[model samples]
Target: MSHSIAHQARPGHKRSEDGVLRKLRPLFWNQEGRLRAGYRVIVFFLLWGYGPALVHGVVDRILSLVMAPGGQWSFGIWLDPVRLAVVVGAGWLTAHYIDRRPFSDYGFQFNRDWWLDLVFGMVLGAALMTAIFLVEWAAGWVAVDSVFYSNESSVPFGQALMAPMVLFIVVAVAEELLTRGNHIVNFAEGLHSWGHLPAVFAAWLLSSVIFGLLHIYNPHTTWVSTANLVLTGFFFGLGFVLTGQLALPIGLHFSWNLVQGNVFGFPVSGKVFYATSLVRLEQRGPELWTGGPFGPEAGLLGILAIMVGMLFTAGWVRWRYGDLSVGRVRLSHCENRLQGR
Candidate 1:
């Protein structure tokens, strides 16, 4: 957790004759003395994925040529794993081989606190979802008929749920890796090299904004919902920075959706579920308070709940790791390589 005070610039001043290269060095390279974080990030993604997408395109063309005049497989599934590998694989390779940096630098170390932190995040997420639902119900914005699980569709509810549950799990994994694990880590490393003390806010905002925008096209999305999603994204990102790994954030993301949509009888970003819950309620009116089809995530109550959760998480971080000081990461001469070994 020890890091260098990277933002500190040398005391001496240089004139224009110091050259244009000197001026440019401050922008591109980590002149403070570390491998350029931005460069590593670029190499990471390139290594993780360069031609798989084009390869997929070629496969589709071959299918069209062979199976039928115009037959083609779905391109969506192909994008899934390749995207995940681009981040997770790239991060692992960059840390272990190319950079020769410790896994802890990127928060990949799986030590004793891993499961403990993950479980804690899930519990907090579940509580946040529950609190929002309760607030809506108390305001009479939501009405409960009874505790019910539907099994009337083409697939029996009992048998049907495991897939969607698994799908949500996949979503949590892919998104956490893509945003918090890859993007934020890259930005943070770059910011650290620039000697930014509190890089968390900047990195978290960059990742969270993208996270919200990604969900902007979902069913029943609203401006309010997008903003709310951005807020939740911040909470999600907070877990990673607070704990320095993806486990806590992944756990929070998965549990929030499961409890919010499946257990609480609310639409998750617009998709409804019939999973087991203590109570089955229906939203009556007041779209803002109840969140309409977008679920409580788009509501004011949900916003308050997430802020409360963030406070709780902040407390947890203080209790577990002391103040939010990860300090600085130092690099040796040979440790600063372009490609990971």
Candidate 2:
């Protein structure tokens, strides 16, 4: 009698543990071992939103007290690195804990394969951005100039190289961690199977569009510039989908900006406008072709170039990573399992 009672109690204890596991499921489990939206939102707010603002306040006050009589602090270079580290680490760690995801899922690994993909993607992305510049020149929309900035001072070749590297880490790793890693996976997991793709695209659009809009305050932004940004977002999102890995898109993004803003001395996605850029332009032609005050990115040629790039990269990713089919590809299946869990 006693033995039978003990056996029955053991089964009951197991049931309680199972129940606990089920409740904790959402915390640890994600679709395809990726982070979810809840995790991303919390981290983004903590790092990008609040963290930077708070740090800025501190730095501003410190500068006010310590600056030379007429010297004003330029927070551009100083604040950027701080924000980059905080935002990237916060997003990564938050997803790891809250969504119960692995860091590799966010493309933190720097394996040979990843480096190869990065190099390829970077080259490809730069070519596309450059093609737009060429079209603008051919159409007589702009006259070429060697200097992108009025200032003769070089930005220290070392600084130019290092800046883009940091920017790449923030843009690629941080953005991937927040959007594709957590937000996309979460939506895919939460929604019905049939709704997964739509959900993913919707999230992609929202995230990408927001990214462009945020740059509105950069330097010279206009309606055309903003539109081009939307296309860029689409391009970036497509890369994320096609590769099923974040590193490729990051590489592409870094290269695009490096070439546009640093190498060519052109506006990056129509944001930063310097006078003496490596690729200089004097707009003597049409606004549509030249991108007007918005930079080259505003032109029709710019949009076309981006679309071409998107299609080419998409094909490459498909060739390398396999077709984007449910279960056939791991990322496609991630959202499904996350929803189930």
Give the runs in model 1 whose Cα sits over 4 Å from its true position. Answer: 1-105, 145-148, 151-156, 273-280, 326-341
Q: Please list the C-alpha lDDT of all candidates, in the order they appear.
A: 0.68, 0.63
lDDT by residue for model 1 (1-341), tens: 12333323322223444676677776766644545766765665565445445654665566556663321222223344554554466566676765556655655567767777788888988988888877777878788866646543454555545544665666787677667776676676565534443455587788898789978989999899999998889989887876668778888898899888767778888776434444678778688777788988887777888889889888887887777643322333332232123
Candidate 2 C-alpha error for residue 229, in Å: 1.9
**TM agreement with the true structure for every prediction:** 0.70, 0.73
**lDDT by residue for model 2 over 133-160, one digit each (tens)?**
6766676666766553434254544444
Best-performing candidate as measured by TM-score: 2
lDDT of 2: 0.63
Decoy 2 TM-score against native: 0.73
Local lDDT at 280 for model 2 = 57
Cα RMSD of all models vs. native, in order, equals 10.9, 7.5
